[model samples]
Target: MNASAPQQSNSTPLCYSINSPPFTYNHPIASAYYSSIFTLLGLPSNLIAFIVLIKSFKEARSRSRSFFLIFLGGLVVTDFMGLLVTGCITVSFHITHFNWRNLDPHCHFCNFMGMSMVFYGLCPLMLGAAMAVERFTGINCPFTRTSSQTKGRPISMVLLVWFTAGCVALLPLMGVGGYHIQKPGSWCFFLISYKGNDQIFSLIFSVVGLTSIAVSFLLNTVSVVTLIRVCCGQDRTQRRRDHEVEMMVQLILIMVIASICWCPLLIFIAQTVLSEADLQVRYLLLWLRFATWNQILDPWVYILFRRSVLRRISPRSDWSRSSIMTLYPTLRETIRRLTSSSLELGEMDEMGKSNVTAPPTLKP
Candidate 1:
């Protein structure tokens, strides 16, 4: 991972540790174009999500709904900032190709960038898991879901995730992990290594990231299944028509997107670190690229899945008269069966009162 050494992959460093000429853009047009596209797409989506969340927060009639919205806002803020910070630096690098050694003599800038990458990278995953836990508890033990009982609890959870991720990102500075200049020299990340502190750091990152994904998947599955059964079963009740449906729909999409985007990188890190194989920079870059898609895709769930937007997208969709109908009723039904029947009985998040229906038929 040293800069002086010849890297095994086809990646070309922007500058070497030894004396060298000032760097210039390696793939100026290609890098600029792609980075621009990424920024353009991600920025607008997150902004829209932010705007929508603000409106929802103001209009939230229940404490539980407000609590859940805080998580959504945290996610949008994290994604928006992540895209803004990383994209700007990456774009400048592609355009200027500044010498890393010359511009970042003490590795301060490199370390900062490296920290930003990790902080932004893990925050979303962690927030997703936290949100799933919030929902799962709200649905299963509505009365005991203390997260919404007090306003401070939800905000504190968001801050806790941030602190945890920030600390993990800073471990390299503490000598527990190491961040190195990576691939084409445009970005820096913790390298996958089997060495002393590095091996521990890599494994920790892998375990934390993978565990967050797993928890989100498992809990979200149970929450969704439980809600489906409560809503569609012969004993349907007010839970089905609750405003929590909005959050549930969005949470499920977030889980699915995060799972798809992040698993490859997390698993790859674990595999290479454990196997003692030569690091493949190309594969790491590939997985990182996939992870970037999480930023672009996540906010769209908020932007497009709004009740107003959903109604516009399909005015025919109805909740009370129908059994949770959507534009894709068949797809909905399939997921309902797969999730509801596949899992044992559970409860739904009682985040708020009914926002979708007049009132569904309730059991006495």
Candidate 2:
């Protein structure tokens, strides 16, 4: 891993070890620049999004709305915490020129960074998976109403997710795995330099995270297809299902964006474990930055796809409407469909049909 000469002249200073590699920044300029910008931009946006989600939760009239707001709020909170813990530390280290690995071995800061990394990093990913699973089984699958659909389910699911992430984060402290200062020494994570429980945990983390993302993608695809079928088949004479289709499409887009941002880093970590290859420190740091982008981008996805927010922000002028239609026709149509009362009437008609079809005058 040393990129410098191992041998040196005897005349070299006594305080300096001949074998020591030259100190280098872990792509300091880029890391500092991007981390600062992302933190600045992400913090306020996530905070506002969290507030909006809370308001949405309060006003939610349907089970679907509650489900989405709960999960979305959890995701926003996770991202906000991530930016606070990781981003602040990263920026401080880069700005102060403090190398974390050089700190005393017994320092609590190392442990703090490791635990924070594991918990916050895993939390949002797992929450996203939980959201996807809930949507898939509850909405897409054919099942009767049951006691499991209580309002407390979201709270239970959120608690379960954090508990699982906490357990994983504690593994290194328990000695089942190891945490070490990674490239650039501003952050720590599951050690990629060893083979053993550390490697095992790393592989599990990578597999589980990537598998969850892939499953979300697959299930969303299936849901979209099923919705399309319903629109074209038995529901053909009914009004267009654009609202449902648009929302499902947005969900898929969010999943794809998250996977794109995080998958490369996970894959690289797995590869490093299996191959034991010596990689450039700067290269790994760059990939880590990519993974961190998910924290910055997630809130924006919620804002952009939110119907109420869009309605409030969209201008009513003819020129603006025309420009919106020209630039984002699908989004314009989705908003139009969302505001339509026809969909509500159709639902009422369907319910009435169900009642009319029931047998009457049953003798007891």
Candidate 3:
């Protein structure tokens, strides 16, 4: 006989004599079922959020409107990515009975999908941190007093957030610890595989995820607390102050809800990476997946449904103070000397002799 035949005979005897672990379909079924539910919930919510963000951007003028629209845009995009990628994996697991060995195509897809999801997932959290910083600075140094303008800052901050998130998500592809295809079917997530020195990978992933989450949490907490203190202490005699307080409260509610939805997922992700045993692993994974669905849902339910929260001003429609001067004749002549328009001076000189008279010129 050939050398291969003897080796095959020897391995076959051992393989037949060995007892393999039971293949449980329960984990795959549960994940698939719930993942479908999450997908259904997420798709519609993200669509609504996308619509609302578009509307808000079109009508936005104030700094608050601009900031909120940016945050909403990032939220909707990332959540949609999560729903698409995660939802597919869930369905595949159910259909194949979680057989990782036979799905090479899925393995490749899962790696890419997981990488994209992780990157996009970080967008909203980073945006939340940026929003908190913006609000805090706005409150502590009102635009009227602060000579420095924020006209370009929000966009710049958003770009930076996405860039950083992208860099973090790419680490896994570079062999720096990220999701990898697990055996028996379906991809496994967490920093380390159970087979090798996965603990080191887990440690790195946990540290990074936790650090980002903690920073976001702390920033948002401080922002809400500071806003509450200022609003509560401000004099109620001013109707404008009361209105401002109401707006601040609404903003805080949105931030708090976002944080609450995301915090659990972050905690569980860290727990999974840090824990060695399979204790509650499947359950925690399920719950974390469910919690992630909130990233899609919150923007739709909280921000989109409450469209009235956006300021009523339209940037293109509203007349500037300069436009107001041009629209009315009497007001135009009164401020003609304050302007550099020769046409306005000529008009003022002619109006000086007319029934419509300018106000008496005052000394500087």
Candidate 4:
């Protein structure tokens, strides 16, 4: 019996290991439903945003464009790409309800998904931070403004963002951080299951990414408050300030929406890392759904809040700054303000009524 007992115990463990069902919280129906919704809704909104951003870029050639216009355009481009890659792949996986890992245990598809998701997701956070810093500096140190608002500067910044994100995404393949198929098996991300340097890398990445986003959100909030106070001031002469205020409001709204979509998931990941707890499939899916929802919401957010500086300059194919000046009083005021702040009210009237060339204050 003693000899038989040892054999039985070993067999029991083997049987349990082989027969036990794996933990899975796959809500395939929900995932498919949301993925469809995201595709249907997100595509059109992002396309419109792309058109608007392109128009803004075209406008930059003739007007004194701000870095904000460039930064916002870059952001839209990134989001658009993200929606295309992540959204489509996710929809495919969810609709089929198939775990690719079952066929290919290494989950190359998941790795690819993770790489694209991390790259595009992190880009916005970093870009948002950059935009906030630029706006803060511009508001506080307008005199120190250099030619940094030029197209070259923004292009350089965008390149840097892409380069940084590319490096981060590659780390998983290099073995520091890693990607794995999340349960429901349709999605993938930084592998929380890895230990040592891999875990440390993931933790540090989360902390830095979340911190950058939080700081951007906070800075934007402060900027909005300051602009609100400025806008409420009785001085009607600060119409340029009013325009600035309007643009800042749009930016603030975007930041807030981004925070809503991302902060909870980030917080959850941070807690999971610190606590060293097993990640639940349901929690991950819920948060991930929220994150993906941002892709759908991003462009629409810009459109809903569009006004003044952030508005589409013109729909006309022959649109030009001179033509825009004729169409928008704000543009005329902005051009006149740039040419000469000391221009009398009568001078503004004359400029408004005439075909005045847009003075370079085309602050995008």
Q: After superposing candidate 3, which stretches have Cα over 4 Å from the reference?
A: 1-23, 28-31, 92-107, 143-152, 182-188, 191-197, 233-251, 269-280, 304-364
User: What lDDT score is found at residue 99 in candidate 2?
Assistant: 43
Q: Which 10-residue span in candidate 1 carries the lowest summed lDDT?
A: 10-19
What lDDT tens digits, residue by residue, belong to model 4 across residues 39-142? Answer: 78887888898787677667654222446677777888888888888778778876665546354443466667888978988888788887787777666566
Q: Where in model 2 is the C-alpha error above 4 Å?
A: 1-22, 26-30, 98-105, 236-247, 309-364
Clashing pairs in 3: 99-185, 100-184, 100-185
**What are the Cα lDDT values of the candidates?**
0.80, 0.69, 0.56, 0.66
Better of 1 and 2 by lDDT: 1
RMSD of 2: 9.8
What value of lDDT does candidate 2 attain over all alpha carbons? 0.69
Taking all chains together, the TM-score of candidate 2 against the true structure is 0.75
lDDT for model 1: 0.80
- Decide which is better by lDDT, 2 or 3: 2
TM, every model: 0.80, 0.75, 0.65, 0.72
Order by lDDT, highest first: 1, 2, 4, 3
Query: What's the CA RMSD for each of the models?
Result: 11.0, 9.8, 13.6, 12.5
Per-residue lDDT of 168 in model 1: 95
**Ranking 2 against 3 by TM-score, winner:** 2
By lDDT, who's the top model here? Answer: 1
Clashing residue pairs for model 2: none
Per-residue accuracy of model 1 over 11-82 as CA lDDT, tens digit each: 343223222334342543335676778888999999998998999899998876888889999999999999
- Cα lDDT of candidate 4 equals 0.66
Q: What CA RMSD would candidate 1 show?
A: 11.0
